[model samples]
Target: MDPNEVPDDDAATSGGALPRRAPGPPRPAPIAEIDALSGDPSFMTSLARGLAVIRAFSERRKSMTIAQISQKTGIPRAAVRRCLFTLAQLGYVHDDNRSFSLLPKVMSLGHAYLSSTPLPVMAQPFLDHVREALHEACSLAILDGDDILYIARSATTTRIMSVDLKIGSRLPAYCTSMGRVLLAAMPQAELDAYLLREELKPLTDRTITSRASLLQALAAVRQNGWAIVDQELELGLRSLAVPIHDTSGTVMGAMNVSVQAARVPVKELETRFLPVLLEASRELSMQLL
Candidate 1:
């Protein structure tokens, strides 16, 4: 077995097991600093509540009633109702008697960022090229908070992961190959703050929950200029990533190719995929110049 590949029968990882799932959709992660932000003069609580209400809807919970929205966001029913009313008035949401759903107009919100930003526009062609050549799923992402946010993707017809990842999807930075490349490029102090702030919850038996082990993995990424995650983010999913740099030679983002672990061995990631991924990373980085 590859040193990085953990067996399926392996026991719970070092840190701990994840919390048992509740029935229905999972509870939303809590909004960070919502209470502290209330004291800031520039912070708009109403706007925050409205955005929270909007975010509560997802692929799993597409159409929800006012009470459901309140339950999902932890916002009060009255506030949720008002926010939904305002959103419906603005045509961003639709109400059909019992439940409310997002409208196509909501795409405008994401389109504004996609249209204004050059990274996603520039990365798309490179991603397409990788997908066409390798016949595998490829993606580009930038570190956002403690997560890696997918900015662009070229997906294969065959799905490899349980989660449907697309632009705007987020995954924890600790276990993903792209996330590791981005994290390895961080300054010492910034990386330290990130390690201190984020919880390294074990997503699978292979996940590195021990701080020392994770630190060692990140050190290797920094030294090697690439990263490989073996079923750490999810069982049967493996990925390889390399850093994309700007003209200044500073790491700006990451590019990665993902494959099903059962179909591809771990060594192929370094042998077959690394060279192409590195070349693409270099070309995309130069384009940013």
Candidate 2:
């Protein structure tokens, strides 16, 4: 049996499982101390709010009014207006006198990161190789607070999930295969802190909401050095992930192969896909070293 595959009875071995709670809406991002930071000369509240305004725009929300930006970012309308005005003046935003939208200049910010970061550049060829070999979507993600942020990806035309995933996509850590692998690599105290603070809202029927169950699942990932999530993030999407380590053997991120759950069974994912994913992660890690 694959070491990553935990038997149904594994939950019974774990002590004191929390009672399952009814699913609720996903938790909102914690509000930053914008007011407190305004007093600090060293802290740049204006710059922070300006960045927040830029982040408010997404593929789904291409254009928005000042009121909508304020609502999305939790910034006051006065501050949001000032930030948008500054961004527009700087040629980063385009205003049609009604709704404001980001210009192509925004790509420069992401471009800077992609240009400087060796991880994405070095991992691209390996990611492409894995995608081509298995004919599945492959992605590289790093841990960002309680979420996994996709920094790189090689995808097929087929859509496996409800969300349109691309670079910069963020998903909850507790339920995703890449998220689990990254979480498993975290120090015990840090992992404990994350579990204490983040609410594990169920994203799907199979999502693990109980803290005990999640801890047990993470333990299995730690032991096996890989994670397989079956429709936990979204229905019909199953993924397998392995951690990418640096020269120091510290895990920096995770790489995953995603496939349609209807098309691939978990057994085949472990037997066939896991080896290729591990090989890709190893190749990427070698370059990092």
lDDT of 1 by residue, 215-248 (tens): 9999999999999999999999999999989888
lDDT of 2 by residue, 181-231 (tens): 999998999999899878888888999999999999999999999999999
User: CA lDDT, every prediction?
Assistant: 0.83, 0.84
- lDDT for predicted candidate 2 compared with the true structure: 0.84
The number of the candidate with the highest TM-score is 2
* Model 2 residue 20 distance off true place after TM-score fit, in angstroms: 35
lDDT of 2 at 140: 97
Task: Please list the residue runs of candidate 1 whose C-alpha ends up more than 4 Å from where it truly belongs after superposition.
Answer: 1-30
- Best candidate, lDDT-wise? 2
